[model samples]
Target: MSLTRLLPILGWARRYDRDDLRPDLAAGLTIGAMLVPQGMAYALLAGLPPEVGLYASIVPVLVYALFGTSRQLAVGPVAIVSLLTASALSPLFEQGSAGYISAAALLALMVGAVHLVLGFGRLGFVVNFLSHSVLVGFTAAAAIIIGFSQVKHLFGITTERKDHFYETVEEVVRQIDGTNGTTLVLGVASIALLVLMKKFVPRVPGALVLVIASILAVELFDLTDRGVKTVGEIPSSLPAFGLPDFDTGTMGSLIGTAFVITLVGFMESIAVAKVYARRHRYDVDANQELIGLGASNVASGLFGGYPVTGGFSRTAVNDTAGARTPLASIVTAILILLTVLFLTPLFSSLPNAALGAIIIVAVINLIDIGEMRHIAHVKRSDLIGLSVAFVATLVLGIELGILVAVVASMLVVFARMSKPHSAVLGQIPGTTSYRNVERFPEASVTDGVRVVRIDAALSFVNAQHVKKLLLGEADAISGGDVTALVVDCSGINDIDATGVEALSEILVELDERQVDIHLCDVKGPVRDVLRRSGLWDRLDGRIHATAAMAVDAVTHPGTLPESLRSLGIDERHDERPADTVDTEVSHA
Candidate 1:
């Protein structure tokens, strides 16, 4: 591997010109404008000091820019990761305590270590275990939970945080009488302003506007005396490098949360990276992304920060503003650094209500109702998976929600493969293509040939199922009149030992029924496996390039079964004319 492959900055810096700087500067500034309010809001979401969010944004963005492949991906404190941090640490330590901070830092370090190892081992494909449906369900539910979790802050009421979403909602309602009128007004007004701005002037940073307005209102109207809570006492200094607590007991408790964070964060980052990479006609290396994210988290841990990941909104903002290289992220980091050094005090009077409103607005978008509708229309089976994940996350808790969703996804995959789709294929008139007989009723099958298409890879889990399905189809056709059974292996991309055994048994049974088994459109790898397993010799060179060719050859009278041959049926002459056959098939 070249140095540039490991450190992407070396590759981009070699081609960096004055022309690239203009867009990078514009993207960087735009991302920075959005980052300030979001960073603070997400930090509070994680139950940490507001400065921790800014601290996380700095090194993570700089580190990922140096190592990540996606030029437009902006690494920072995202709402999901922050909510996960809060969920994991809330039970172990009180929010805003030194112990909670240490635990959060340790979790980041552990997650970073896992990402680094997976990246180095090139195990980025492990994320395939997390199905897209599960992700959608989990994200939608988590977004709702995060939004409701902020109700206390929005209402300026004190309530003990609960694990389940309903418990939180109940607590908020129970404390409704304690709601501060001024804080509620500020939060509601901020959310309304953000919604309007997003609809009317999308180019403007509405969160920044809300923050500025809230701070000015609090300072000018003495809103603090009227029960409107301000952020209060933000430290104006850069994050000092520090080591996380290395206590084994704490480490043991955090390992599970850390693993969850590693998987979820890497999945979120790489997904957004691949989207923009594909749109721009470039490929994203998943392993390299794992490394970049790992390095970022490691830096975050060493600098008294919690876990962080690439935020989709900020990345979209970076891309929309014309980011040409990782230089945009570097610029974002520099601006955030400037904020930590000199502008922290300006946020001192920033209202917590405004921060809550910003989080609610930003996270609500993650609940994709349109995606749910699409899934429902396309596949009802997926609706079960989505509902399980969404309800599990909302009712059980974040960690258990992910666990249940993963298990459910795996089970769904296994079930689908075990009962894989095998279709009785028939040729369309004057076309080489074959389709399912049940779907295209006008398509005709050869008189003495049965073409069965097993539309899944032949694996151990579905080996017997495929055999049974083919046998059932053959039985459904005339019992002993079909002399040639062509198994269309076009969809069978691979075969295992169990699949080979299943095929061998299928051949023996077909021979007993006085039928010759032919394999058509066999994939190269599957053929290689069959050859090695001695099934190729059993096939006796009956394989053909396509299903239609196999059927064409077997349609001859000489190839017909003894019973069909004795019936004196002319195989070459269709007893039914082409038009008549089409009409009969279509009506049937």
Candidate 2:
């Protein structure tokens, strides 16, 4: 690999245009202002101190600017990754304890290590196993869980964290009467302010506005005395570089969580990156992205921060604010570094209720009811997978929930492949083209000939299924007197040993029944497999270039159609040896 490929900034930095500076600066400032509240809020969501979020926003953003492929993806503490961090670590230690914080940082390191290994190994395609349905369902469920997990902060009530979402809901309901009037009012007002600003003046950073107003309200009115919780005394210095304690047992326990975070974080980051890359008409290398994100997470871990990834909302804001390159991310990181160094005191009086409100508002859109409805209309099987994932995530904890979601997605895939679509084909009038007879009722079939197509690669899992479907189609023809069967191999791109064996069996059965079997449009790979299996020699004179040619051979006997003659085939072609004659026919 080249130096420029290893460090993406090396490629883009040389071409850095001065004209982009103004817009990059503006976008950086905009996101930096927005990240102030969001980073802190997401940190609290992850069960970490607010300063850790600031720490993450700084180092991760800068690291991604150096290694990341996207020009505008602003990397930082995202809500989903934060929630996963908490889910992974909360069982091992008390939330926000020194040990818990260290474990969180270690998790970031482990996640980054996994990403780097996958990137180097060129295994980035492994994430394809996480199908869209699974992501949608898991994201919606996690959003709900994250939203409700903030109720205690929002209402200023004391409640123990529960393992399951329903337990949390029940605890919230049981403690509803203990809600602090002051805190509830502030949180509700904060939510209202965020909503209004988003609707009316989306260009402004609403979270920042809410954070400032809430801090002023708490400080001016002495709200803490009335039981309004505030983000007390954040350290007013930049995070010092350090390595997390790597206890073997803790590392072993965290490996699974780190893997989950690695996949989920990269999926979220790449999804947004691809969207922006397409809009800008640029390319994003997936493996290179893994390396970038891996480096960013490693930086976060070393700098006293938790795991981070590309957040969709922030990336959208970055793009809309006119970020043309990763230079904008570096600028944002600098702004965050300044906040850590000089502006930490301003947030000391910030209300926890305001942060809770911000988190709730941010995650509510992730429910994605519109996407679920669209999935139901477009592919109900996928809806089943989505529903399974949603219910599993809610019933099981987030860690096991994701495992179940992946399994459900795989099962859905296997189910589809095992029973893939197959159709009886018929020739359209006045054309050599063939189509599904069921779809095109006007298309007519030739007497004593059966044409069938299976729209999936043949494998052990579906070989028997295809064999039965093909034979059934041959038998179901009117009068059941089929003299010839034409297998359309256009859709069969590949075949395994079991598939070749199944075809051999079908050929034998057809021969016993006195029906000639012909294969047409056989893909080169499938043909090679058949030849190696010694089936190609048995299929010698039966294979043709197209279904139309096969049908004409059986129907017209010694005469060649004008269309076939136009392709330069002579009348005496069939008189040649089977190998020579087959070689003479066009495979196009």
Candidate 3:
């Protein structure tokens, strides 16, 4: 592999246009403004000090810009990953405590290591096992959890953390009477301002506006004296480079969480990357994306921050603000670095409620009711997977919930594959085309011949099932009159050893009933498998190019179809040798 391929910046940096600087700078500054508030808010959500979010925005953003494929993807502390970090570390140590902070950094390192391993191994396709339905469900549930988790800050009332969503709801309800009126007003006003700005002035960074306004309001009105909580005394220094503590016991405890974060975070990053890549008509190598994200997370861990990923909202903003290259992200990192250096003290009076409000608004759209309805209408089985994921995540906590959803999705896939769609086909009127007889009632079927098609790869899991279905289709025809079974191999793109064995058994059973078996439309790969297994020689002179040719031969013996005549077949049985026949059939 070339060095440029591994280090993507090497390829793009050399091609950097002078004209791209303006847009890249504009987009970078816009996202930087947005990330200032979002990064800190997400950090607080992850049970860390707000500045850690700013720290994450700096190093991780710079790293991903250098290594990532997407030009517009803005990598930082995202809402879902933050919630996941909190879910993982909250159980082991108190929120914001040094132990919890150290563990969070360790989790980022572990997640980065996993991504690098998967990327280098070219195993990025493993994320596809997480079906879209499962993601929708899991995301929606996690959004709810994240939104509700911020309620204490919104209301300025402390509540004990609970394991389940309902328990959290119960605690919030019991403490409803203790709500701080001043904080509630500020949070509500911040949410309103954000919503209005998003609706009317979308180009403006509403989160930044809210942060500035809230801080100014608190500083001027002395809101802390009114029992309003504030993000007091942010450190005015850049993040120092340091490795997370390497405790084996802590690593063991965090391994599961780290793995989950790696999968979930990479999935989120790649999904958005692919979207923007398609929009701009470029390719995104999935394995390379893993490398980029892995490196970013590693940087985040080494620089006093938590795990980060490409966020949809921030990426959308980046693209809209005219980000033409990863240079925009680098600009974003520079802005965050400047803020950590000089502007940290200015945010000392920023109310916690405003940050909570920003978080709630950010996650509001994640609970997608419309997507649920769409899933229900498109595929009820997928809806079941979605519902299972949503409920499980809400009930069983984030880790177990996603685990159950993945298992359920895999089971659904296996069940469908085991009983794949098989149909008895008949010829359409005045045409050579064959279709399912059940769907095309007007189609004509030849007597003493059954044409069956199985629409799945024939493997050990479904080999027996295909055999049983083909046999059942033959038996469905009146009496023992079936003399020929034409198996359509067009849909059967692949067949394993077990499938060949199953076919052999079927051939023996049919021969006993005095029925001849014919294979039609055999794909090249399946034919090769048959040849290697010696099944091709066993079934010599029985394979044809099309279903119609096979039907004609069975119904009118000692006569060859005009199409077959060109292929050098005899008028009697097709006596062509196996090797030669495949060559002719492939061309036909």
lDDT of 3 by residue, 1-588 (tens): 689988899999999999999999999999999999999999999999999999999999999988888888899999999998988888889999989888888888898999999999999989987898999999999999999999999899999878889999999999999999999999899999999999999999999999989998998898999999988889988898998889998898889888888888888889999999999999999999999999999999999999999999999999999999999999999999999999999999999999999999999988889988998899988987898899999999999999999999998999999999888899999999999989999888888888998899999999888888877766665533447889998899999999999998988887776778898888878978888888887876677878887887676554223334455332234555454443323322
For model 2, residues 1-588, the per-residue Cα lDDT tens digits are 898999989989999999999999999999999998999999999999999999999988999999999998989999889999998898899999999999999999999999999998899999988888889999999999999999899899989888999999999999999999999999899999999999999999999999889999998999999999898999988888999999999999999999999888899999999999999999999999999999999999999998999999999999999999999999999999999889999999999999999999999988999989988898888987798889999999788898999998998888889988878889999899989999999998988898988889999989999989878776765543347888888889999999988998998877777778888888778877887999877876566778898787766554223242344222223343343333343334
The 10 consecutive residues of candidate 3 with the worst lDDT sum are 579-588
Off by over 4 Å in 1: 430-433, 479-482, 552-588
Better of 1 and 2 by TM-score: 2
Alpha carbon lDDT of residue 383, candidate 1? 79
Highest TM-score among the candidates is held by which one? 2
Give the C-alpha lDDT of model 2.
0.89
Can you list the residue pairs that collide in candidate 3? none
CA lDDT, every prediction?
0.86, 0.89, 0.89
lDDT of 2 at 420: 82
- Every model's TM-score: 0.91, 0.95, 0.94
What is the lDDT for 326 in model 1?
94
